[model samples]
Target: MNGGILHALLEFAFYYPLVMSLIWMSGGIIYFLRWERREPSRVRPRPLPDYPMVTLVVPCHNEGAQVRETIAHLASQQYPNFEIIAINDGSTDDTGAQLDQLMDQYPALRVIHMSSNQGKAMGLRAAALASRADFLVCGDGDALLDDYATHWMMMHMLESPRVAAVTGNPRIRNRSTLLGKLQVGEFSSIIGLIKRAQRVYGRIFTVSGVIACFRKSALHDVGYWNTDMVTEDIDVSWRLQMRHWEIRYEPNALCWILMPETVRGLWKQRLRWAQGGSEVLLRYTTRLFKWRQRRMWPVAFEYVMSLLWSYTMSVIILLWVLGCFMPLPPSLYVDTLLPQWHGVVLGAICLLQFLISLLVDRRYETRIGRNYYWMIWYPLVYWLLNTATSVVALPKAIMKRRGTRAIWVSPDRGLR
Candidate 1:
């Protein structure tokens, strides 16, 4: 009996990862098919008789070194009727002095100095209150926007009155290290593909906080930036969507931001994100399942299932690691193990899915002119890092009490 139980555990351990790999590969195939079917024509341009008033709100905390460059980038945006507002969230560094200098340099730039660190949610709320623009672009101090990014985003929102918010495509600004190369893959494969899926399915899970534009009216409707959750962006996106507001994904509107160059940094960043996602799920789980809001259930279901799935993967990996040293019973192995031919069939399907992902990423990266070599090791490096983070994050999220906040940790910005 003991040997039978051990064999059953070992079989579950070995095959579960393979099952997850198949599911991920299947998702990749679906994304590729969608990409192939998408229209190739450019988004039509619409003339605006009067450009809407735009406010670019940047939240800063201990970002003295990079805040000036971010301000300069915002100041240089080509939009004629936009104001740049930088909110200093009680920085203990020279961030205030740096902002003061920049404020003096550009009359259009405004700075709001907080006496002590109140977190990003408070800073964003304060900045929104200070601004008088119809549309607000919230950004981090380390993020740099493309010259035409605001123009493209605003045009999309203006043309489509129903679009309550726009999410920018965040690309790695510095890719000098292997970790950075892996992150490039992460953005293209995992993050980018998920965003495309969400769009196709008419349900976006979270808007990237690094750079996202929200209509002021929608902000008011949903109650701007709830401070209770660590991930205010995720919470707010769900809030807007629940209220029947449309969120659009603008892949061409680019924002350059630094990605973690080390495993430790990446782990911390994803931990915070995972925790925030859990908070959002808890806060909105009831609304997510209501009969009137049935359409939004799939989005919430995906997130919940993903969180549970990560925990399962961690357990399976742990079991597999232990199983390698132990002998398994013949009966259990015979029952659970796939036939050799079946294994070969599954392997071929996985290979085909991986190839499809590679081809799609390659085509997208080629148009953007990034190095193609980065795509080769992406499946190993990027996917493993994600799985590891999810394993760590999901547990912390569940065990930790609500109201545990994570302050903004700047990514490795040495190159920038």
Candidate 2:
């Protein structure tokens, strides 16, 4: 192959990835514009006949160290007519004992101990069955909710009776290490952008499991969480939407979750999330075009495209790297050719968008310093890390050999 042809092929290869990124960025911008224009005041609160009974359910497995603090936080909620139920899903540690101690201190608290580990879905199922409340507030045992978290979530639900579920913001509680800081930035950009998009579309794609409120009737309508899939949260969200039920994103309702402090820990946690997401896509792929509602189609398309893009971009990155090292045939090179000017322009756009995301992060409560230099470097490093994870997850999820059934790995615990 001639040098010119090889260069052309390399350039074309670059354009494919650039195009994907551009599409994502464009969608993100549209989402932001729509979200900014939304009038929060216009969405007036509905006067509830009474403070509906709420059951705050915490599903735990080998999270003994964090259970007490989590329970204490739930017990501290200012909301009236609420119960705190902590389901210990067969914790090998002293989680049962910790819950027992809390039960004695707070009579409103209830504990359910399982003989064996049955993952979060089963734990939540058990907790929901035990509670005799009008609403269910499901959260992780390692999560800490803000004082007004439940109140705001309930208000949102009341305001939008069509909404089957309400999801709150999940902020990183541990940003002491470099890894943690990068995660904070990544989460702020990705989740923040997605939530804004969801608000605009009036269809939330997935409710963060860290803290979400669900109408008991909605769960019953959709048949609750699917224990078969690894990502029950996402599965349940899709099911709710399929039933013509609405889901709301409440930024004011806040919950803090611990991020993985170490690189290894972070990788494992991401693997489970990525794999679970893919599984949800696979399980619901058929429902994509079948759903009669227009809202459901867009949400389904977004999720399917996201998964495909992740794996496709990973392949493009690898091809680009190989093209740089090995001599390729002229035909292959030309087919993948991208212009240098396009690369420069695309790179600048990505950098600019990333900066905007960083600014959004600053608006939120972050422990990291608000330095311009640090923010610039943070996004680049975080993007690289995310790309690497997506690359690894592509194959791991394909093999269906990764992820754990045991709930011992608690990334949220370290955040507190």
Candidate 3:
């Protein structure tokens, strides 16, 4: 084992992410407290006003059988004044024919059939153009939007004119695989917690595309969704906020969505996400300097630090693998992951973070939290996977030429 500089770097590699996670937890708690202090009506009230005409955009590529369930969910939303515009983006399957049949059964539902497959951004944009409503909700064809989700999401937009988009909390539907079960906690511990904290900080890196609500005016102001960005969710979130439209996180607006069930699928999904973040950074560097956009500096700084930590850890791991050829000190080799004091401390930190997030998100559990025991291995797996994904994805994103068409891919959700 080395002392001084090497020791410090090793410590930094372990604790940097831990410290940031703690900060996010604290921020989310603070936000929760503020919400409690506010009036109940202000937090979120029932029987939302006006019942304004709302349009839902269903973007499909090759949605297969699951879209039947998705359309059923849309047809079942409890909201009074809403119309469905389901976009069949040139699916090679019977999705277009299926949608046409569904449309006849549900007259409120209108079908938009694209002759050729473009991408989600184009599909959403086309739906937006056809829509007569000011507010629009977009979701993938596999997601199950709660009957009340539209009401809750609509409330946020009606409450404020500045609110441009409300990102809904997505709950995992498939719990069949170990990977799927692990992600149930992953959403609360990582994605959900970060979103709550980032909202309190006055900036969010991106919206959850799986379930999101948008204002047509805001989309028009930003020129609608950018087709070039691989992740339209990241691109649209940045574009709206840069134009001074607020993006709100609506936890009560629950959308049940499926996630990847294999290491390969999980890796691909995460790499795509990481690459999307890098693309947003590359495309929007100039906007970050504007005086009005200063509030986003903290958000930008956090992302930059995340990348630095990921790359530094990757280099350290490579060196450690090379050092494996030679004999190492017994003390240095002691339980790098557990059984030692530092390992125990780091593990405790991860556990505490998840517990805090779990507390805040308990209301939306939906029979999912019964698998909490699986998350015992969460702290061990989350960072290791993220570091490797970012290491590979960032460089790929950079090398990719700008203006590449953003196509869609169906994630491998382990469901029979």
TM-score for each of the candidates = 0.83, 0.83, 0.93
Superposition TM-score, candidate 3 onto the true structure: 0.93
In model 1, residue pairs whose N, Cα or C atoms come closer than 3 Å (at least 3 residues apart or on different chains), thus clashing, are: none
lDDT of 1 by residue, 179-240 (tens): 77666666765676667667766778899999899998898998888876778899889999
Residue 95, candidate 3: alpha-carbon lDDT: 91
Ranking of predictions according to TM-score: 3, 1, 2
lDDT of 2 at 25: 55
User: Model 2, stretches more than 4 Å misplaced?
Assistant: 1-49, 291-293, 321-325, 331-373, 378-385, 391-416
Give the per-residue lDDT digits (tens) of candidate 2, residues 1-416. Answer: 45654455455545644654455455556755554335232133334556889999999887877888898889888687899889888888899988888888999999998898788988888888888996999999889998778887897777767888999878887767666666666566567666766666557778999999999889989888767666778889988988889887766577888878776777777777776766766666676666376677766676555555555555555666667778755443323424357656755765665566655445446433443334445534554565566667656656664344534344533443
List the candidate 3 regions with Cα displacement exceeding 4 Å.
Answer: 1-5, 36-45, 326-339
As for lDDT, the candidate ahead, 1 or 2, is: 1
By lDDT, highest first, what's the ranking?
A: 3, 1, 2
Local accuracy by lDDT, each model: 0.73, 0.71, 0.84
lDDT of 3 by residue, 1-416 (tens): 35454566677777887788888898888877876224242233468768999998899988877888998998888898899999999898999999989888888899998888789999999999999999999999999998888888888898999999999889888888778888989998789989888899898889999899999999999999999888999999998998889999878788989888888888889988998998898888888998898988888888888888888777667656655776655433322323366667777887788788777777677455576778888866767898988888888888998888888777786664
